[model samples]
Target chain A: MKLVPLGDRVVLKQLVAEETTKSGIVLPGQSKEKPQQAEVIAVGPGGVVEGKEVKMEVKVGDQVIYSKYAGTEVKLDEDEYIIVKQNDILAVIQ
Target chain B: MKLVPLGDRVVLKQLVAEETTKSGIVLPGQSKEKPQQAEVIAVGPGGVVEGKEVKMEVKVGDQVIYSKYAGTEVKLDEDEYIIVKQNDILAVIQ
Candidate 1:
């Protein structure tokens, strides 16, 4: 079953990190810090949340940077996703 | 300087835990779990926060139950306090 986050939550899928060296050697990101970048997968319908009126700013397919240590990780049908409040998202990349 | 919270933030002072048993024996609450209860010391004037319009709900001198681990602890003038969002407060005690 797919996750349907409530309130100002947004579903995000982390982008795979691939670093290319100057000589064009590709390296896995296993030894590096976990990237804070993710792609928006699902957007929650914005309305009132916790006594506040929230407006959804990010749409699906938008690349976003989220706060570290934010969101809950969920695994659904062999796919993993992070569910975070829209406020936890720091910025959208282009 | 006294703390003045911003946005929907609330400054709380933890209530001194004094439990009196049926036998009239006063007991300190240090052996038990940290109390989630606090007294509202300051309330922010709510407005637009993180692109959402928030309305202040709790007021100063109100006793509240806040979510555990949901606030930032600060020391001001040797007094410890917690600063939390209005959403972190679960209920106001009558």
Candidate 2:
């Protein structure tokens, strides 16, 4: 979907939770908590700095690791998404 | 209680949740969710920046706003606390 971030917030598309268990048992979504993994789809240019410009360190399409409980949840067009700031991001996976 | 931050992590002392409602009705802890406000107690020097020094913007004793679900929970001496990186901090309230 065409989702745009507001201000310094970024939109993340969550990755699906693991379905197969170590023993090869398949678990359905109703039986497990949602995983926190995500793929970056959009990001703000950067946060404002003293009326100056500050470019962002991360770009779109980067896989990132973030706090499972971090960011505010939002649902757009029946799709779940998260809104987090750059500072809330822990690290980016190459 | 004395707490120390490791690496780029910071320690925060949580603020007490409001007891009185907007209409002055008293809500007890068991009936309400914990508030997410905190006062900074300690901070790491800074995150690694190309092996160079980068001082932290927030300082000790600064009141901060953070994600309600951010950080790992830890209990020291029966007191619950959170361990979060500097990046997890949203903003410092001056």
Candidate 3:
């Protein structure tokens, strides 16, 4: 199923969480940190907001870092996706 | 001390948290929610970020809503401020 994000919103598939520390033994699922990186799947066409032209900066295929507690998680077709406003995204990894 | 935010970052002074619900009985400070609204105090110059020309959308004096879990909090001269990237700002209240 395709995901279509609405205004200033985006859909992202999370990157894998880190399972090991510097010492090299893998940690359990319960000890894995929340993933902050993700690949953009879809982006909304930003429009007018409060008399300002909201611009969509990040596009599909861009890998981004987002706020940990900022997005809503959804499961569709057994795949997990995160939906978040553009503002919650911290940066686009080059 | 004067605050000068770095590229695409903004300095904001938080708005007061609600002391009570609609019914109007004052609540304790510990029960107050984290403030989501803030007045812009300073704005950073728009600059290049990740090969993209990052533009500053909100100006000084705009009241903005930011991600609740985002931003770095700092205190100077007995004043508290939140420093956040432009993307962490959700909306400007016009």
Candidate 4:
């Protein structure tokens, strides 16, 4: 929770991929696709461009959707984290 | 330039892949890699999360880096555009 992101970036903890559908049938882990959902832990301080300031729109504690293929993956304390630009986020879950 | 992206999305015009290096030696056009750099054409109205409004950080005309494999590709009037979430964008060119 103490990680400080820079320049409109976000630190996310990806949700675990689901193995069971709503129908209650258990599925093999291999059949489940990677999860695009994540929980926001840290937010960037924003950046500047052409004399204009670009501020972070995502905040801490937001549940967001992101591109599975985007972002750099990292591991700390056996927990996975992904560092992505704010642009890579698809949506914030209400 | 008139496209209105939705929900933290952006409209990007991908830069052409380089076939020639600064030394002027040219690679076959077929062998050139796809470019991940793009020019921002339009930006979405940011969405809401947890009763807070998320605002756009990227603006039009930003030359940005992005994930090559992300976004939806579309063509209008022979111009190609990629609609990507804001998080898919990596960096803005200064």
Give residue A24's error in model 2 in angstroms.
Answer: 15
In candidate 1, the second chain superimposes onto the true chain B with a TM-score of: 0.78
TM-score of chain B of each: 0.78, 0.64, 0.77, 0.72
Fnat of candidate 1 = 0.04
lDDT of the candidates, in the order given? 0.68, 0.57, 0.67, 0.65
| TM-score of decoy 2 | 0.42
Off by over 4 Å in 3: A18-35, A50-52, B1-7, B10-83, B86-94
lDDT tens string, model 2, B1-94? 3444534667777765534445322445564333355788677556443333456777888888665443654333355455566667787766
- Residue-by-residue lDDT tens digits, candidate 3, A15-87: 6454433321222343122325578999988786444456777788987656545689999998999998776
Which runs of model 2 end up more than 4 angstroms from their true locations? A18-35, A49-54, A68-70, B1-94
Question: How many residue pairs clash in all the candidates, one count each?
Answer: 0, 0, 0, 10
For each candidate, what's the DockQ? Answer: 0.04, 0.04, 0.04, 0.04
Quote the lDDT for B42 in model 1.
98
Q: Write the per-residue lDDT of candidate 2 for residues A56-80, one digit (tens) a residue.
A: 5557886654444458778888888
lDDT of 1 by residue, B1-94 (tens): 8999999899999774434323222232432222255789999998988877777767899876554456888998889999999766644545
| Highest TM-score model number | 3
Report model 3's TM-score to 2 decimal places: 0.47
